[model samples]
Target: MISPHKTLLSRFYLIGVVATIVGILVVAILNLATPLEFIIAQLQTLRQGGEFLWIHVVAYRFAILCLLATFACVPFLVILRRVLTPISQCLSLKNRQQSLPPPLELKAKQRLINLPFIMAPLNILFWIFIPLCIFGGTFAIDKIDLAAAITFFIRSTMVGFVSSAIIFFGVESHARKVLIPLFFPKGELSLVERTAKLSILKRLRAFYRIGSLIPLAIIVLTLFVLYLQVNAETVSGKTYGQGVLNFSIVVFILSFLGSGILNRQISRSIADPINGMLDTMEEIKRGNYQTRVNVVSNDEVGVLGDATNRMIQSLAEKELLRDAFGRYVTPEIRDEIISGRIPLDGEFKDVTVLFADLKDFTPMTEANDPKQMVQILNDYFKEMSAAIKSKSGLILQFLGDEIYAVFGAPVSCKDHPSNAFFAALDMEKRLKDLNKRFVQQGRLPLSHGIGIHTGQVLAANIGSPDRLSYLLLGDAVNLASRLQTLTREMDARIIVSAETKQYLPESQTRNVLVRHPQPVQIKGQQTKVNIYLIK
Candidate 1:
């Protein structure tokens, strides 16, 4: 897809092309109007001096060649845009898929591949062949001393080649490392890897910057030396050396200005989207999901911003769902659902279910004030619930002073039977602790009995559409309740069925005193079930 950033870049390129075309037309018209006669006249006068005056002809031809080259180069730039646009689009797509940020090495290799394909051939024609053509054209047009013209051409060519090589490689390398990576697929880089790469690039850039400065200084120094040498040899009235100095200064200034303009454009192209992405990321970190990166171009950075914004929107929606779900379900259940570990439709599983109730809750309610009864019940339930949770067993439901809990349901534990046994033991220990506090207060302690039974039960959501409870149902759940009823007969604080006893490890089961296995008729079951008591 054509990104907004790419669309903007295309528009900018079109505008640049139009501006270049107008500039070429203006220069061409000026050349045609001035005519070649004026140039020819100036050369004739210079030739009359005892000095072999081919300099004037060479200078005039150079100007004409430069003007024509500008016109040719502008069209080549337009062709370059045509070639680079599709490649930019492909890179935009690739960046979106990359999870790991692109490495500096990979980025360097890509630039190496693209440069030769897109610009190398054009650079050879424009920088190398074009200068040769200018010198040849001047030699033919003025019919000046061929040998003198060749010597000047050779000198100019050497300087131009050195200067152009330094400028091209310096700017291109900077663009590849800094500008291109920002726009391309940037995956997360490890700390060590990122730091090492950045350090290397920083050193390389510094070296290149210093290298570029040296050549620039040398070029200026050479121009100054040439000026002094020429002035020393020429008469005061003559300005031949002055003219050469002026031409050289103008060429250097124009080249510097052009390079500066290109660099600024490339920097802007790289910086705009990267800055936008950083700003958007900061907003996201601050919990502002409303923020979106403005698409400035159709390049890689623009595509990244678009994708990141979409991801933030998705995360915001999930946050909302989690907040809503958390109000109804426990965080554990919410996490299980969100993580896709627990299916919405619950499953049948083998679970050790526990049902506990205050033995004389109804009498306590009749004897005590409503507030006092509630306080006592809260104290009891809190202690028991904490014990159950500590064992990783869920408190499925709490009705009045009665609590229903289960182990190995929503999530299974390998030692679920042992976990349930520990929970019951802990509950008994807590009851003794509670009684001690009650005795110190000069009040009778509260008492509770727990019955645990292990069997397959349908564990699921039970209740109306508006109100739901995660609970277990079947003969196993009823057997647990029946066992709790037998607590009074067994004279035991904790009771378990024979089946539950079998599930516990021998280490834990060894502590229990089996009050001879007796078949007891539970309310829902036609057959009697054997139960045990823990001493």
Candidate 2:
């Protein structure tokens, strides 16, 4: 099977070939329409000491030479292909990374784009001068009248200019749509320093505007030349009038063709960017924040691209902030806060609150080095926090060697009490593992007291206007802390309130072995709270 790249390359040349054929047909129709009598009269005038067929023979040869010269673009197309081949490889999905290295790609791209700018002027000059020299030289040798020679030169140059301009525009437009994308896939025309000043939009507009006017100008100039011919001492007015009519028809055809090409060029310049941005927006909507619009021009489209990039950047930063913020609070709470679902004014909810404190921590700190104490505390918090997070417990705050955790409030969890119970167990297991590591390092093992309670509490952002924190406000919070302090008197590691045990599911409460419930008055509570020691 033929490669897609080869097919595209072939199509590019095919477009040029079709354009060339159309150009030739246009010129041929215009030539046939010019008055035959006028041409015969010019030949008769040049019949001075020469065969009548000489001018006819010379005209036929000139047409053949023009055809051959136009076909010469085939070789030029080959050179263009060579220049763009490396860039094409870079754009190929299969060969993307293995294509020409960056430096080579840049050089190839520069050469490819610069090819048109460099060749257009030369092509135009070649078309204008070559025909002029051939016709003028032939007529001069035949002793043609100076007026007729000047007229022929002017007419031939105009035809050449119009034809060459069409080719120039066709080549430029083709490269822009095809080759340029391969070179700068993201439409990053800025990287090529030279063309950065000459924006693609500006170039396209200029080409369209100037190209549209050229055929009209050609029509006017052709009419004027016909008027001069008619008033000439040797020319017939009737014949010249017919010539003008035919030339006008040709000009109308050329103008129609030029208009079609210009409209397509203008549409591509505008539509391509709009379509690209739309696709990128769709990608972003699907949560792909990395997508960005390719800014190809310095116009309104470029402004839109800049705005899109900024929007995506802002979204990406916000996402990163949310992830970092989730570390301080739980993801559920963070999401609730962001979505405005959690009330800042506060609402009461039955939440499971748990507090854990290091036993004999003050004595340990007094005996150990400050840095070592800090390391141990950090290790303890890290392990304990991981356990709390695994059970969907939100860490409310850490006051020195104490940690406050809550289950259900900003976001509700039906098994909050059971989750809190499991989290306490996980913490005990983690503490044992931590103690083993400490003992292996020849350090004293650490212990902790944990108390859990389930009751109605106000969960909301609290504090001064400038600074606020999410806090659980109610007697349940104090009871939990007081029960943690009671761990020393009760000689238990974990204490669960009777209210919390009532919230636990039957499956969980069956496995949990608790000592006889004791009605104890908790500090800050008006009534006695019933609590149980967990085994």
Which is the leading candidate under lDDT?
2
The 10-residue segment of model 1 with minimum total lDDT is: 189-198
lDDT of 1 by residue, 110-194 (tens): 5423442344345434545554676588788975445434534443443343333333343344444444445433332221221
Name the top TM-score candidate: 2
Which clashing pairs does model 1 show?
Answer: 4-297, 5-297, 5-298, 6-297, 6-298, 100-187, 101-186, 101-187, 101-188
Q: Model 1 segments beyond 4 Å from truth?
A: 1-335, 366-375, 438-444, 462-468, 489-491
Q: Candidate 2 on 88-170: residue-level lDDT in tens?
A: 66556434455467776666667655655554555556556655675578677875545555655565555555555555556
TM-scores across all candidates? 0.46, 0.63
Write down the TM-score for model 2. 0.63
CA lDDT of each prediction against the hidden true structure: 0.61, 0.72
Count the clashes in each prediction: 9, 0
